[model samples]
Target chain A: MTLPPLLEQSVAFLLPYDFSPTVLLVCAGAALLYHRGWRRTRGGWGQALLFWLGLLGMYVVLQTQFDYYAQHSFFMHRLQHLVLHHVAPFLIAVSAPAAILGAGLPDRIHRHVVAPLRRNRLLGHLYAAIQEPLVAGAIFVGLIYFWLIPSVHFYAMLSVPLYNTMNWGMAIEGLLFWWMIFNLRAPGASDMRHYGYRLLVLFLVMFPQIALGAYIALSNHDLFGIYAACGRILPITPLIDQAIGGLLTWVPAAMMSVVGGLVLVYRWKRQSQQVEQPLSPTLGCAR
Target chain B: MPRFKRYLILCLLPLLLGCSEEPPGGWYGHDITGVMPDLEFNLVDHRGKAVTAEDYRGKIKLMFFGYTSCQHVCPVALSKLAAATRELGDQADQVEILFVAVDPKRDKKVLDEYVTNFTPDLVGLTGTQEQLKAVAKRYRVAFSYEKPRDNGFYIVNHSGAVFAFGPQGKTRLLIDDQSKTANITADLRRLIEQSSI
Candidate 1:
């Protein structure tokens, strides 16, 4: 199918790009609140920049050629997964969108939307459970392995219900997992212990991806059969395409995890050193 | 002088050998240099000799999925391949053309004479119905024979693309039919040179 020119397709850049009511409401509401929050919170341009960039990343992944060709190409699909499950989530978390957006919402919307959700004991417990390093890590690790299983992967491409659920599952789980990793506070524990736990979780997550990538890269057969008839644009064989996809998921994804962990360590060290002076207390609270 | 010669020799070795390395980026057909698909087969050739993928390991194999019975695509594709081989001239010995018959039932008896009609060197292979299906599945070659007519001759619709593998036993490329005969010949010649390296 011939696509409309990018100049003509410029209209899709608007949020709620897909007609799903939930995505529309959430994106629209977040934009309004984030705008207000940026102004009200005063002088947090860095945080605002990261948040907007995160949203832009999501829009590109969902609306651009990445989403269109991802169905037919393994490497492109890996790219979509990387943006949604890793990069966008990291940026979104670092921006602390929840706190800023909550503070910025109008009184009635806050009362009806944020207040009730905060008040729900069941949700509070569930959210608290997912925030734990072990639970969050296990759930995230499970999702990575579960989706890539050949039988599961093949059918997910064919079934709409399964496919949508998998996409949403990755987005939500990724956001939560990265958020919990960076925000490692637990009740009254020392920040050192918390940082240690975060570092460990980051290390643990890399193993599964490395193993999955090695298997795919090293395999001689066409593990993903869905692309058996498709891969001729670059005129690649199915096995070659899959190997490239495996490398994308394997090495770069692992490097990103390590980089995130290193940044946390550097920040933690800076905070610990600052604690010797008066400014240390506020530095720890900022992230 | 000895040190300079050693340095020059080390640098030139890779450029000369080119083995255990990738070909240059731009090529005529698909450039799948390292992917090894399931090309295993233990079938009798038209000449009644047992042949497998290993037997053709040292040469570039152009594998086609077609049969002789009800024929337009099969004949055309195979004939073009023969032309491509002739186009290779002196280097033609380095290529093996494999025609795997889709209809094993009727093709078992006629493959030799049929394949020779195009070129004597063109190897025709057929297996039992179960074995043929297994091979077809390996190459992702989907074909179904029509329910046999009263005359007992039915058309077998199959994937007609030709898959080329390098001498290193790695699946390399799918030659496009739209590619000119000379282009196809150049592709095969390149493949032969690439594997010999």
Candidate 2:
């Protein structure tokens, strides 16, 4: 659907520059105080509420940025999607008060709440979810594939809301899928010492995008329609921006893989050393 | 003349090869992934107060080891971290995120300003070369400095993972390069719960 030009221009103006309005900050503070008392009253409810609030705040900032950047060029629009869906959710997750929530509960109440999560039905479901490494792998790989596809990417660029949905949806869903898989505490078969394996999976996951990037860098063709049309006003060329995106994707992914491999190797060596060494007699005797 | 040549050759051998000894491999705890040695180091914060692994005890710590000059990943990681804390709201009070510069020479005020751009709660740190080496050694985090030839721009090689520590100042988990917020939060949640006395 074609956006009204006036509406598009206004949203475009607001998207890049939108900050957390003063009123929202005050409300967020008030919400914090309101939630503090609830912390003792409910088990995980407070945490869930806080999580939603945080998500809402982020959504506001991201939406504005998305709107602003989407109007200007395809590259900034993609970046907005990157921040909104992938990075934002992850940040929100990191900010979660799991430790506080877990600690504050009384043992009885905690057990009452947590017992259901560990029951056969829940455990069975969780176990199945965590066991499917391919599912997580697919989500990670698929998101990159779908978004990076030239036709699909350009389509999203043309329709701002579609771009928001596709980009953010892929990112959020991908993170959730990976979260379940990587989480050691999740149900399913427990031992996952193959740190190298996990690293390789993500490496393979990123390989296609890198391949796409190399193709873009080498090709003489002007692929992106949006950039091709709006050439004069935009400061940078689409090809250069595309190359930068490709570089961003590959370099960080490669580094993560290498460091992850080193950490894995280091750990495997340590675990083997521990096995070879005699246990402390006192600790063994205590057991 | 023959004796002088031999002496010069002998002197140059240690300078080149000796500096390349691999960093120590042993660390104390199991991080988010595998069992590895806890890296140890001493560096001063933006406030000029010195901090060690000990000082960070009693709180869940998120540590990112990077220099201020890093153009991409470091800033992205720090920005995401700030976003996470902003997302955390009250929960942020319990967490401390630190950015330690691998490049000690240019790190101090520069990193401090850079970090504050992301979040007030974030602390920027640097140290003397000896101190940086010691800290990087303990963490098993690696870094190398490259001198600029023509261009003013030079680069330092450094690790990209953000290490998470439990309340006791023990290394609990590694954030890795992925920087997935959910995975980090999930692990931190588990660590926080497990680490409490």
Candidate 3:
């Protein structure tokens, strides 16, 4: 009685789509506006869009794997995890100034939501809390090794609830991981070089996965029965899927390194402009 | 103007003189109070011994907050603490190291074993969720659990400073995560000697 047929249909339609990307954009825009308008709108949005485009590309990669092979092929399953968990989220975090949210949002929403957050003491504390390096770093490394070990990953793969939980867990980990690395908030502050170094550290974090993936690809051991089943169904050989899995680990991770570097450059230039701004004539005359 | 300048220089004299320190080292350059906040708590140790902040009195306690399930930083910090203790040799006796598990639910007994695997001297501590919150609040330590989507496995967020407590059982210093073992050893030695005096 609570659910009519049309009501059920409407609820089903509303369930799948996520508004997270738009929410993030609005938040970024608000932060940018609070800092004042970008020196150039198109340029700032373009850079942000470029980063968003890269994120979209990675998301597509994830969607393809999730749709086609998550349950069907072990190799595709792992690749999907890698893309969603590590690759796409990092691209999104480093892609903006806080201004994206401000620029994109309507005035009424800005007054109601954005204005309040800018003044919020709890939000400030929350920001400070997450920026704690030890907390953020541990979460990142913990999720990786915890999920990577054969015992855990194998069990998660076998169980439906665990598989879904872990898949999203990695993405959340990815968000927290890059938030510490990309966010300008304090409690833990690292310069551009440190950010660059941390990316290398993250790359090393995934090294074990690459090695394991490569080992699985090269060896005849079919840990999962599905990989064997899919090998028979596919046009290409199983070797190709295995190779793709290993290569995907290192190759896509390079995107994170490049993203880190670009964020460093962007932040540094923004800082320099603020620091080296020419003094007003009125102020100079007073001096 | 000369009198004003004299007073100005007089006020600034402490800033200059305060920069000076004793022979090998001094912890005066940084504002220790800003880096470390006063914290007090009652908890239990790995051995199930009832413990409180008072137990660490008279010794300079080096405290690191983390969970046993942590794969990298926790072990790295404990190893560094061990290495620092080794580096101190005799002086290590004066410094007490404590690791408080942020995820007390799973980490209570689990961390106890994990930490012992690294160093017997390192004490692993935990309490009920409410108690952990009280301790974390007092210490200005931040932590959160990201809800697990499918399985019950989620990450615990926590602060990662190696806090140094004075002999009087008050937080007196904080060593940033990047602080090296050699620097930690030197700092601990100085804190131990200073507190004794």
Candidate 4:
């Protein structure tokens, strides 16, 4: 069976460099749920496109040959985290797929599994605690710092379990943080009703990220030795690699906060508009 | 304390636990005990004999990845390992340096000579692409070849780490470029002493 060279190359690129069943299962499960739910709810075309793109983006970075470069290059690793922790999660959260996913769930399963789980006091309290704006903001930034500590980063890069944990943590935390920012529920019904508080968290988190990114980018020495320890895939100098990685951590990442703040402003405006138009039946029934 | 505060501390307990600085055994090298898997490989030795990690069982092994043609890092790292083993005196025999050649194609002819230049304790190992990939992935290390130059010479980049394993093949320490020969020797002595007991 001889395949065309281009097709073969594409296949190789799509194949996972280091396969993980967890990545496969989670991605496939999400896609399946979204597809089923989309048919039932007939969600907006734009939202569906965003959800699919976000899911595919996360899978591509985690499961494809891209992961091999991420393992070997400092810059590539930073890019992967940026996608996992910011861009892809941002798209997924902004799409607001929760209602559709819930609709996609089998009724019996939702009744017996999800409904009861949601009603669990401990789980509810835990969710509320994590959803607290200050707590969520702290964890969001804290994870980035914790994983970047040179010694911790060394082990995280070298150990497969730790590496998986780091990536998963970033993806999960990004989802939670971005979901808090983008959730469409009315201010009175939501955990953090004041958009002002979220705006503050976003603004506060950006400075620390900028400082950390700037520190790494401007540093003369190689802060992360793991890349050198494990040979880099690219032929670039260590300093160049570190610089590029630091810039990724610094620039686009902080820019995401600004973008998120803008989204918050828009939502805040829309909420006020809805409140003023309460007499309209459409506006009253929207929630 | 408030209930929410107590819950917040509970949620954060694991992160705090993970942040603890010191590795338990306190080896000079980065302690990787139980972090990486045991040594296991199928490769050909410098003398062209097919061997497995089992062939070197009961002896402490310090595995490193490099090609024979590596001009600087490989040579310097190999020499450092040689010197570290030499400083171990009579216990030198207990430590074997497995120099796994990532560029098997270019290294095949000169591999034996390359290892012998450093010390008798060094063993040059090369393997099939599948075999090499397995070993490299097992250690979370990587190697890649640069584009061939006009002269047909190309450079291969590889891990500069030296992974130390105990007699039973359990991974213990990772020695990087910054680790001095004395520190490596001290760790090797500790590794040997622990195995003997």
DockQ comparisons of all candidates to the true complex: 0.02, 0.01, 0.01, 0.64
Span of ten consecutive residues with least summed lDDT in model 2 chain A: A278-287
lDDT of 1 by residue, A232-269 (tens): 22345667888898997899878778988987888688
lDDT of 1 by residue, B1-197 (tens): 99999999999998787763344554666554443363588787898887788887788888887787856877888888999998888899888899988777788888878887879879998887777766665554456666678987776656646778878567787665555677788788778777766
Write the residue-wise lDDT of candidate 2 on B1-197 in tens digits. Answer: 99999999999997777566322221222233323345356788887888887777677877877788889978888877666555555666777887878786777767767766767888887889888766654554446666764867667656666767767666666554554665455555556567655
Stretches off by above 4 angstroms in model 1 are: A1-21, A229-234, A279-287, B1-197
lDDT of 2 by residue, A1-287 (tens): 98999999876655533344443564465446435534663535644564565456555545454444443454554455444444444433433444444554457865787766757697867656744555666665577667767767644543434645674575567446434323333334323444445556655655665676566555565565434422212445556766655555555434444543454466456655655684833110000
Q: Worst 10-residue stretch by lDDT in candidate 4 chain B?
A: B18-27
iRMS of each prediction in angstroms? 9.9, 18.6, 21.5, 0.8
The residue ranges of model 4 lying beyond 4 angstroms of the native Cα positions read A184-193, A279-287, B1-25
lDDT per residue for candidate 4 within A31-125, as digits (tens), equals: 98888998998888988898888899999999999999999999899999999999999989988889888888889989999999988999988
Q: What number of backbone clashes does candidate 2 have, counting pairs of residues 3 or more apart or in separate chains?
A: 12
lDDT leaderboard ranking: 4, 1, 3, 2
Give the least accurate 10-residue stretch of model 1 chain A, judged by summed lDDT.
A226-235
TM-score of chain A for each candidate? 0.88, 0.58, 0.59, 0.94
Write model 3 residue lDDT over B30-90, tens digit each, in one string.
2244333455677889988879887877777878878877778778878888888778888
Estimate, for each residue in A96-197, the C-alpha lDDT of model 3 and write its tens digit. Answer: 444543554568878998789977999978766755555566566567657756546544543444655786687767766776666544434434345445
